[model samples]
Target: MGEIRQRFTDEFKEQTVRYIQEQTKTIPQIAEELSIPAGTLQRWMSTHRKFENEPLLDREAIRQKDKQIHDQELEIEDLKEEIAILKKAMHIFSKERN
Candidate 1:
């Protein structure tokens, strides 16, 4: 009888790819840890060889990048506000002197 197929998520694949690329252990070791057959992991890596060079971003990495962008935007806004306030204070001081 043929073995039943299993579906893995993009995140899982990404993580697995990342793990494999890390080279901390052999493919068999990682496959054992992930509860997948060694051949299956080998096939996945081979099938996605193109992406191995330019790794597919997993959800967590994308989220962290988004959060970084948001934080930078907030910081820019705060700096702009501080600049505006300084300008106002300078204008007021100049008017009082004049």
Candidate 2:
């Protein structure tokens, strides 16, 4: 396999990660849209959790975080639904073939 190379600067990485965290899109979707690895964005987000001074999160920011959490929960539900559908389809197909 070829080595992976990074093309974006630190500012770009930070902005992309912040956008990913704040947006309604799933991590996979964000990665696909931004052309960055989901794992890389995920790791960046983990690192961001240790901010010493975040300028004191305002009520709006708190609301935004709540929204982000809700969005992630929805995404997880969607993924679970998709997995269930796939499993059901697979079982039916397997029975039909047997």
Candidate 3:
């Protein structure tokens, strides 16, 4: 006789995937703890958590990356302004030196 299979809810699958994401353990380890097939857990993660095979970053992670880029842009602009000021100062000092 074959063993019976169990079904899991969508919410439960999502939470399991999330737990996998937020923890340090391997998929097999988590699956073993939860008594689910590792392949089933991997499929749940890949299907529910990815887009076209690429993992999607969370909204807060995207926001933080955007903020980091914005800060770097501001820093570049500030450096450009400082360089322009320094060039003008050098021009003035060179004229006085002549």
Candidate maximizing lDDT: 3
Model 1 residue 6 lDDT score = 93
In model 2, which range of ten residues has the least summed lDDT? 48-57
Tens-digit per-residue lDDT, 19-83, candidate 2: 76566667899889877788988887776543533343378978999999999999999999999
For model 3, what is the error of residue 81's alpha carbon versus the real structure, in angstroms, after optimal superposition?
24
Per-candidate Cα lDDT values, in order, are 0.80, 0.77, 0.83
Query: Candidate 3, TM-score vs. the true structure?
Result: 0.50
Between the candidate structures 1 and 2, which one is better when assessed by lDDT? 1
Better of 1 and 3 by TM-score: 3
* Cα TM-score of candidate 1: 0.42
Clashes of 2: 0
TM-scores of the models, in the given order?
0.42, 0.44, 0.50
- The better candidate by lDDT, 1 or 3, is 3
Per-residue accuracy of model 3 over 4-72 as CA lDDT, tens digit each:
999889998877777777775778998899999999999999877733333335788788989999999
Worst 10 residues of 1 by lDDT: 48-57
Off by over 4 Å in 3: 50-98
Clashes of 3: 0
